[model samples]
Target: MDYRIPRGTYDILPENSGKWQYVKDVFRRVAESFGYFEITTPVFEMAELFERSSGENSDVVQKEMYRFMDQKGRSFALRPEGTAPVVRAYVENHMDKSGSRNKLYYMGPMFRYDRPQAGRYRQFYQYGIEFIGSNHPYYDAEVIAIEMAYLKALGLQNVRLEINSVGCASCAKEYDLALQDYYRQFLPELCPDCQKRYETKPRRLLDCKVKTCQVFRTDAPSQLDYLDEDCREHFTQVRAYLDASGIKYLVNPAIVRGLDYYTNTAFELIVDALGAQKSIAGGGRYNALISQIGGKDTPAIGFAGGFERLLLALEKESIPLPGITLPKVYCIAIGDEAQMSMLPILSKLRQSGIYADYNPDKTSFKAQMKAADSSRAEFAIILGEDELKQGDFILKNLMTSEQERLSAEDLLQRLTQ
Candidate 1:
């Protein structure tokens, strides 16, 4: 029987693993540079966590989340996003009581039941940052700076930053009323989903992709215009901090986070070359999320970026990424006895932190040399009957074709140096 990998997921083969690792390392370095420590959570959590944090009406919970019941009939779900689980851990572990701010980052796979497309997947990797215990607008800009610095480190040039404010609950309540008043006239022409969203989440109507629903969005109530005094001041401070940090951005009122928890500052990084899935990364403040999910009413902000889209953007811009590593040395032995002798030296070389490779199956000297060259090794250590008898090996520099006879101890010293 022939089996296939489930749709919407792809393997990170050896050829592509190096690139993944390189980007992950770059994100870690940038996050740490901003005083963010790493935090990891379970791949799956109690289903209610998301329903509460992301909102029951959010697309992720309603149409995309992978929900299941365990053998005990207890409902569970693979996390669709990273923020809620990190907040759950923080609250459960009492990180809030530590009397200091929590700047944390995480990287891992997120599961969703959405349609798979270019730069979109059922199982995709995400890197995110969460700044807890502060509503200070500086934390918002600082979190954004980490993502900007990471993209710069990866040499992505065509990405643009778009920022917005969703305002607080009171402001949202007023804005929702304005949205309803404006859309009530066109209710008959709205999509069924938007019709329901009219009463449930008016902000979601602005994000609808249907052409019919999109026509009304151009004149929809802008969230920025509805921002109250505190929210307006917060947005201004965030923009000021970004300016002081020398990060460029645009104020886009159309930016609404897909989740219900986001408030005040919302932003996304866009790459126009990516077409419909142009947003490479995005996040916003969730001041009420911790309290909504059973923690002290601590304020926090964060962002998450998908590695797949980020890599695709890098590709579109022709940015170079690390590839498969080649061995430093490849061993070739002409005979069985020589092959046996080469084994210990190969082990020694690897033990001394050298990337050494060998293939005992190839017995012909010519075939072994050809394999060594194909391996792209810097040096080829050749073991033949004559060299074995003389207690020495011939080290050939594959690039320079320079040959030198050296004792096994001497070869180790030379390679180590």
Candidate 2:
């Protein structure tokens, strides 16, 4: 028998660490560039909080939440999505009182108990944004643009952007009724879940993956046709912005988002090369969710990118490192006396914005030389007793395998150059 990580979990080893660092740096820079402030929230919240926001009928609340009874005998749950928690923070802090539209972003793990696959995880990470207190479709377009920018920044060329309008609560009411009426024609044929959806949330039937139920409703209504004057205007504006930015999108009427709270403007960025899990990110607007969860009524639109899926997409695209690399300097001390000399030099190098590394215990000349050779460093400052006595140091160019001896001040000037 062997001890091992549970199924669906993976250890990110050293080589993969570079990629992870890159994603973090890219996200921070891009989100800030778009004026999205960072918001850090707890991994778990009151069970009722998510239930109210995600909707009690959502798959997340009903089937997938990692819930438990806290020591106080109160129920809480590991968040399955980022928006609900962020909204809770926003409302609690009265963020709306200070800002017009609160733009926030978060990155962390979300727990789901579904059967795991290439893209799905029991405990998966997500990076997402929420734009609260803004109903204008321009924010919707901007959010889409930011997601596109992230994918483009990662050098992903094969990704596709899909968009849809599930209509507002009033409009969804109409669509849902229409869907139920249409699916009633195929009542005996729908899968078990679709059957449930037909009665509870018929719009979700459009998103059904079952082949038998996959048939588009013969008289299926497009929300576009039923959009009220306000929803219609907003959707048009969003399309205009996307067109001006030349962001390609598909108007997928069938794109009913997974969460029940989502109302209008559903979208996803998909990459298929990473088998099974084709979506890299997905989200939409929830115009009335604020009041639904006990906050002031505030309209909002946002999206969350799948962390595991995004990394997999990057792997397929071969994007370069995600952030600025470390400084190029190296430390090489030749003898016992010189090893002692490295301590102050290390302090100085760090203060001067150089990345320095050396092992005082690696006392052998061959071991030191091998270590420096394997460091992938750009330059090595070789300090030994004679060189120290001469008030000079030997500098070796790791790349060209060239060496030169110079006074300490001159060597600093040369290295700085």
Candidate 3:
């Protein structure tokens, strides 16, 4: 029987694994440099966690989320995003009480049942940063700076930053009312989803992707106009910080985080070369999320970026990443006695933290040499009847084709150097 991978998911084959590792390592280093530590959360959590945090009216809760009931009949969902679970952990672990700030980062697969497209997957890996316990707009810039630093480290150059202010709850209420008032005339012309969004979440009307609903967005009221004094001041400070940090950005009034928890600052990193799937990363502040999710009333901000889209952006810009790793030494043995002698030398090379490769099945001298060449090792340790009897092995430089005889001790010392 033949089996196939599920739709909207993919395998990271060995040929591509190095690139993944390189990017992940770069993100870890960059995030850590900014005083952020790593945090891990379960792949699935109670379904209501997202519904409450992302807003039941949001597309993630209403459609994209993967939900099911376990044998115990409790509803659970594969987390569609990262922030809610991190907030859940912070609250459950009492991290808030331990300190005035919690800077954390996470990278893992997020599941959503949306139609698969380029760089979009039902099971896609995401890297995110969450800065908790501060409403200060400086933290907003710092969080954004982490992403910017990560991209810069990866040598990505085609991306641009776009910022916006969604305002606090009070600001959102006024903006929602204005949106309803503005979109009310086009309610009949709206798509079924936009029509529902109009009544429950008018702010979402600005984010509607449907062509019919999009026509109304051009004339829709901007969220910036509705920002209250505090929200406006916070937005101003965030921009000032970004400016001081030498980070360039455009203030896009249309930028709105899809999640319901987001408030005040909102921003996205766009790679224009990727066309429709242009946004490589995005996030914003959620001052009320902690209290809403049963934690202390704390203010926090974060952003998440997809590895799939990130890799795509890198490729689009022709940025080179680490590829398949080559072996430092390839052991080629001829005759049973020589093969046995080669084992201890191979073992010592590996114990010394060297990448040494061997193939016992290729018994013939010709086949073993072919395998050694194919392995792409820098040096080939050739063990044959002559070398085995002489108590030394011939080290041949695969690249230069230079050969020399060395005792096992001398070989180890040379390779170590």
Please tell me which predicted candidate would have the highest lDDT against the true structure. Answer: 1
**Tens digits of lDDT, candidate 1, 229-262:** 9999999999999999999999999998766668
Could you estimate the TM-score for every candidate?
A: 0.98, 0.92, 0.97
Q: Rank candidates, lDDT, best first.
A: 1, 3, 2
TM for candidate 3 is: 0.97
Better of 1 and 3 by lDDT: 1
Q: What is the lDDT of residue 173 in candidate 1?
A: 89
List model 2 lDDT by residue over 1-417, tens digit each: 999987777787777777787787788789899999889999989999988877787787899898999888999999988888999998999899864449888888888888888778888888998999888888899999988988777778999899988777788787777767767878898899988888887877877878777776545777678788887887888899999999999887767766656777989887879766888899889887888888988889889888788887877877665443543667878777787776676677777878877867677667877787777778888887788788678888889989999877787777666
Candidate models: Cα lDDT each: 0.93, 0.82, 0.91
Cα miss at 100, model 1 (Å)?
6.9
RMSD of each: 1.2, 2.4, 1.3
Q: Per-residue lDDT for 378 in model 1?
A: 99
Candidate 1 to truth, TM: 0.98
